[model samples]
Target: MQDFLFYFLSALTLISGLMVPVSKNPVNGAMYMILCLIGTAGLFALLGSYFMAALQVLVYAGAIMVLFIFIIMLINAPAETKRKRDIPSLIAAAIAFLMLTVGFVMMAMSPELNQPMPALEDAETLAAEGAIPFDGSAKSYGFGLYGKYMLPIQVMGFLLLAAMVGVIHLSKDLHARSQAMLKVKENASE
Candidate 1:
């Protein structure tokens, strides 16, 4: 049963992940991302890390995706002006790569990553309970979120708020530019 589930989730994740790139519409691509995230969460659940799975759905598929869609809508961004798209994508990709490197380092340092297999007594208790223990779940995540990571999370929220303000400012500038262009065209037509 577990094998079947794992394979099913693997296929779902792969297919949806593929769709994310192939979907031409940014909105549709974002929707596909949600599907992919859900599949990933299923895989996490099958691995017995249900809290991570829930977080995957809640944090990623829910909040982050909504933010993405909101930005996409608010920007209604102009037809891919090369300078606009290229520069931002390059900057974002570089930042993502750097962040990924930092993430791998943090993962390597995690005590859980070095943990040995569970003891026989603990395994027996889990079996008797017929449920994987919540040892890997919300308590630890909440602690880490509120403890060591609180400052960074708050900083990120501020950064996002700033970015939103920048986007609104850009939208106003773009609108003003278009209106100015229209005026110029009308004056020339006179």
Candidate 2:
């Protein structure tokens, strides 16, 4: 059962991760990334790290993805415009893509990629031989964080708040500048 869940989550994670870059639209890519992050959280849960799983979902899929979507929509970015298929550029792109594919394949087939993670091996060994001690929960998580990670967490929270304020201030000024630019362009055209 554990093996089945692991494989299923692994496949989902890989598929979603691939879709992030394969999707034509940046918005779609960000959505795919959320799916990938969720899958990763599931994997962490399977490994008995509930705190990590919650953090993955809360931090990556929730906060980070929201920020990504906000940035994607804020600029009101357009879809990638289609370009004329010039032969030379097409050939160059093909060559570059081929090289990248080869490099990725080589890396995928490397010994390092094949190596098992020590943490995972330890988890599996414990599960197989004896009871998997339940050490992770919301209470434990809060205790651990407030005990040792309090300063870091507070620092990150303040940083994120500052960033939100910055973005809001910048966006307002950006909208005004863009409107002014549009007025100037219209007057020139007239």
Candidate 3:
């Protein structure tokens, strides 16, 4: 079951990731990116890192992706025209491919790359260690987050709040300037 879920989510993530860049519509691309992020979060959950999974969902999928979508909407970018691939772009892509191949070869030759995985503790042993028993309740997760990781969480919240305020200020400034220009035009007409 775990293997199935891992493969399923992994495939979904990869497909969505590819779709994000390949989709012609900016809105569709953004939506695909959000799906990719969510799929990655699901994969994280399958790996037993509940905290990471929640953080992925909360920060990347929930907040950052929404901001990206808003920015896309605000800019109202027109659909990109299909362009011919020039020789320089092809050469750059070839160089990138060669570099990746070299990196893969180096990694494969390294002994550390083939290191055996550590044995994981069973649920019974984890319970003995006083790890919070996973009762599937949100309260336990919330307690762990706010109690153990409160400082980092608060910092993230403040950063997000600052970003939100900045966006609002930029949008309002543009709107006010446009309104002022309209008023000036009206006065000039009068």
Candidate 4:
């Protein structure tokens, strides 16, 4: 049952991931990416890694995907162009199809991939031995992030701040250029 669930989730993740890259519309791509993240989280849950599953949902699906959707809406990407099926694109598609088929065959041949996991024995013993340390919960994650990963967390904050400032600067520059073009047109009309 778990093996079947794992394969199903894996297929879902792969299909969604491919859609994310192949979809021409940015909004649709972002939605597909969210689905991919959720499918990945389901796979993690099936593996008994609940902490990873939660992080996958919260961090990737919640935060990152939302940010991507916001950015896509802000930019308002142009409508996709309808191009004739070119030879190069056709060749690329064929290659991708072949690769996917090979991957599926490889997975089917691997019997270990379908095996079930061993049962958990002692929760406290696992924690003390650091096998599954820190309760594997959200609260423990926050504590570890603030305690051991404080410096990295602060660094990520600064990085995000820098990126925000950079985007603001770029937008301002574009606005100034557009205004100057309008002034030039007005002067020419005089």
Off by over 4 Å in 3: 97-148, 174-190
Task: Indicate the TM-score of model 1.
Answer: 0.53
Q: Lowest-scoring 10 consecutive residues by lDDT in candidate 1?
A: 127-136
TM-score of each candidate structure, all chains considered together: 0.53, 0.62, 0.63, 0.65
On TM-score, the candidate that comes out on top is 4
* Clash number by candidate, in order: 0, 0, 0, 0
Tens digit of per-residue lDDT, candidate 1, span 14-89: 8889788666678888998999999999998887778989989999999999999998998896654444456787
lDDT of each: 0.83, 0.85, 0.83, 0.85
In candidate 4, position 169 carries an lDDT of 88
Error of 2 at 61 (Å): 2.3
Predicted candidate 4 versus true structure: per-residue lDDT over 74-94, tens digit per residue: 888687778675889879988
Please tell me which model should have the higher lDDT, number 1 or number 4: 4
Q: In lDDT terms, how accurate is model 4?
A: 0.85
TM-score of model 3 vs. true structure: 0.63
Q: What range of 10 consecutive residues in model 2 has the weakest lDDT sum?
A: 124-133
Candidate 4 regions off by >4 Å?
89-135, 173-190
Error of 2 at 52 (Å): 2.5
| Cα error, candidate 4, residue 56 (Å) | 2.5
Which pairs clash (backbone N, Cα, C closer than 3 Å) in model 2? Answer: none
TM-score of candidate 2 to 2 decimals: 0.62
Give the range of the ten consecutive residues with the poorest summed lDDT in model 4. 126-135
